[model samples]
Target: MQSSTKTPTAGGRAAPAPWALVSVLAANMLVDALEVSANLVALPAVGAGLGLPVPQLQWIVSGFAAGFGGLLLLGGRLVEHLGRRRVYLAALLVFAAASLAGALTDSAALLTATRVVKGFCVALTAPTGLAIITSAVPEGPARRRAVSLYSFFGAAGFCSGLLLAGLLTAAGWRWTLAFPAPVALLLLAAGARLVPRDAPGTRAPRGPGWHATAGGLGLTGAVLLLVYGLSHLAGPGREPARAAAAFAGAVPLGALFVAAERRSPRPLVPPVLLRHAPLLRSALGAAALNGSYVGFLLVATLHLAGSGRSPWQTALAFLPAAAPLALSALHSARIAVRLGPARAVAAGAVLAPLGYALYPRAPGADPGPAGLLPATACVGAAFVLAFTALHLQATGSVPAGLQAAAGGLYQTFVQVGAALTAAPVAALYTVGRGPALWLVTAVGAAGACVALGGLAHRGRPRARARP
Candidate 1:
């Protein structure tokens, strides 16, 4: 782990320096999320470096998710137990070391190990960043703004990573892996200087227990099985025997996770979260919405530029979608406050699929600024609206103590949605651009349906958002 140089704050406590502090927290979360897709543009380079089989490549990234997503709850607990300041610094150092190691390594095993380690660091940091937001910024708009920045960075980092990876991979794969090192260094320095210090809680648990470890292992295996099963069965050219086996494999793990969680004393994921009636469905909506939303972005980009679209044109087209989000986000809080979170999320769900429905009608037809622009704008804007509302609805419903865990659970669902349709989403572009997009649009509608049934109600002023 990389060492942090923290400064003393009020009460002679070690803390991060104050100055647009929310931006700093957002930056940290953004960096972590971007790593999810950071290597995509450099896949060829990384594959060569690691001597990877074509099939093994996804593991390089999925392994990180396996590490990060699995440990997120544990990471939050560790932060509470050890003190956010210490955990934040230690996690940054780990990330830095892994980034450096990734840059220097040629061995697939070594690079993948570093990625997994970095992911572990990221898991620790993400929830802690929100915790920091809650602690540092007082409630209401201040914290809301901070969280907005965090979410915004996440969106921006993902988009930027693709662009940056493209540029760097053109130079060499090392640049893509190495790019994060300097940023990590800067973040470490800033974090040490600015983040506030809080002493370890006397009552906080010592560390993660077997129950927690088992929970993550069980849950991840279940999710991976589920993803593989669906991917193979529905995806093009998929083998029947293998797909059947994958489906068979997923069933036991899913059942085991449910049974295990129901009994564990120190449960990996607290069962209460899974049982939250409104959240259970809303989280599914968030996952489904994002899965198709990001899926569209991935395939749309590939279809546009995968063949011959120039870098500038690709950037230009995406920007139209990107630009409206910032403007629309300014109104998200107000809309949620007035309209309620459930409706807000449902509205976004409708808009995204609606945009997809339009794709076929107006395939490549220049509909001027209002026409072509609004379609993608709906996709991005809906993302902002739904995700923000999900945060408000899911987290706000929970007791204060359970907020981080709830947030993590919500995020896990989002990842599940994203993971489920990789092959199906791929088939869209691989099969035919128009047909593939329409399929994605239909999937988006399916997600909207999930949101509408469970978490998709209206007009009740509930708890306000947590930063």
Candidate 2:
């Protein structure tokens, strides 16, 4: 792999600073994470302004997930085939444009469309940025630190988005949409100066064949349909028929994608990644963390609302869950080195369920912020311990050239898993919030089991790069 520690400039002048490159990438990741949580707070305002029903309002959030989760794998390939810097820059430009358009739009459908467009843009940038970090920062302690910093930005962004959304909504929901445009532009300027250009020889010698292209398209469509279905189940409309149709349609598309991969000279997903146990476990662990957190957020907010807390108050109450994540960036590298990534992940996974189980189960029980701290703090600790480790486990095992694809796969699991887990949990909310919490706890336990399972193969050595 080419050294990203420093790159030669054309003028032989001082090169762009390495930390600057990482900051540009990490900041963009913050933008992506912010988008996911921010709009959710603005959903009611959006519905009131656009005169849309609950179902359409739900799309304002779900549309982004569908587009992002669906396109990630293909976006990763594009980064591999094209250059990471090229794709990253172009995606940022499009993201800025989409954010601007979203802010100006009055039509509900147009707002959702812009969200989907921005999601596609994020689909390109998020993994590309991750791939850049993995390739640029050599493996071992340095890479762990870099990955931890990247993961911290994401966790912090999600937390920041909620608070920002609360503040911005008072000005009007459009500000929520408008906020990221300038942020993207700023990142774009810095990225152009900072992100190293892809080496001339970095591009693939040959592009995907017709079979691979077909398989890629099929796989993307299948993922889109599946996520869309799963997301709608949790939407306020609760349109089971539409969700069922999407689910039913995805089966055949997925089967065809599998068949095509078998026949293609170059498959959409590398076969080696398929057999990689560590990556798979990492993906599942991330899924459990994200899904349960999302579900808990929904259930917790509803519980708080029942106690007459305003949305702003609810956002504040969750601070315990988000603060540790940002701080974790500083120490996660040490934790990973000390405990091993797998063990760290498993240990963190165990904490989440314990926290969920500790949450006050009765609807009438109004746990003040202080009472809620233990639960939220535990969830936050889970992220501190596991989130960065999960990223490390996912990409560390893959070849440097395939880092982007591995990132895409890992993120896909995270996004789609949130939808899948949150759906049934949401449905169970009507039955009882306690059951939803139990479900989230169960998922966390299952994730912990999966991570623990990876520990059995004592003879298998870890994949690493020599510094």
Candidate 3:
């Protein structure tokens, strides 16, 4: 669990170069970004090769989403106990292994299971990488720029998958599934070099015993169910009663997670961070924005391509929305600074919903580039504007030591929102696009309300100036 090299920061020595940490974290994040989007282009190939049914194909994402969402907190905790370097290498090895398994498998069950296990491994390392960046760099303009670039790169990496999807998918699903292995291998190598060892300090690290493990298992179960419901509900005219059951089962299980976390000594989620007003808003806000954004996307995608457009054409038509996420992530910092973290959350909550509301009018009846382009841009911009806003604000005040945990908690909600929204709103489209779009509009607008509610607390006269 100990790091291999001596970390200068631990001894009041000069810290590692900011870029070093950023580079390392970027690689860490890049693979995660790839994992989320890479599978999209291969879905058709996967179905054909494996004799998979369309509805059951949800496992490509839902399985991973369920797994990733379930284990995030435990991932953060593993970092705390294991240290970033050890956990990062260990997880990436597992990640690469799982990716390889996904590549070679023709069995639907096996492939889906590999993706799920890969998600679990990714869950372990993803948060830890960001935490390492935060810990390596001092909080200031340097850390701000570093974090922004890292996040921006992550956002950019998502779009990069789209560009590469063409080449990789054309080559075959095996190529797409297996491609991430080299990236993971590179990160694992860099991890060995750039990462410093943590020498034993006076304080002993806690062993991640039964309670922590059990709490994580429970949380993972609940989130998996939550994502399953979301994706299942959204699939094309899928089974209604079954999806409803998934949603219903997930709800109480989620409650049980809250209960378990409270009871555990070494809780997967720390209580203070969980209950923080601004932080909670950010976590939930990321979830909302992604859910609405991705769901609307899924609907728009199906409508455009389902109407007989080529796969490449469908990807091209959606370009406007896809382009802005990386572009706007750069400005995320300015938004954070000008508005301060809390107000930024409020801003995202506000803009994102309004953007969703405009969806019906977007791309117009003609489906011309002018119409679709503007809408895609608006929605894409909304995510960066809001997501960055939330990220900056959410982690604004956490103690240096808890940075990893905060990241884990933040992403936990991110995937949960995605998982929860994917199918439900898509299912709503059955009533019509008019109804489905409105459903997303409503969901996004609700996040804006939550953000503003934080503002309400801000205005209540400061609690009589604390006497």
- Which has the greatest TM-score? 2
Per-model TM-score versus the true fold: 0.79, 0.84, 0.83
Clashing pairs in 2: none
Query: 224-336 in candidate 1: lDDT tens per residue?
Result: 66555544443344566876887788778777766767777756566677667666777778777866765665555554444455433444556655555545555667777
Candidate 1 residue 254 C-alpha distance from true site, Å: 3.1
Q: Distance from true position, residue 350, model 3, in Å?
A: 4.0
lDDT of candidate 2 at residue 364, scale 0 to 100: 75
Question: Over 4 Å off in model 2, which ranges?
Answer: 1-15, 47-61, 106-109, 130-151, 205-212, 231-240, 305-307, 395-404, 427-432, 455-467
The lDDT leader among the candidates is: 2
Mark the 10 consecutive residues where model 3 has the least summed lDDT: 458-467
2 or 3: which has the higher lDDT?
2
By how many angstroms RMSD does model 1 differ from the true structure?
5.3
- Worst 10-residue stretch by lDDT in candidate 2? 458-467
Residue range 208-319, candidate 3, lDDT tens digits: 6666677777776776665556545643556668768977886777677777777787577777775666678778778788777766665665455445554455556666
lDDT of 2: 0.77
1 against 2, candidate with superior TM-score: 2
Cα-based lDDT at residue 306, candidate 1: 43
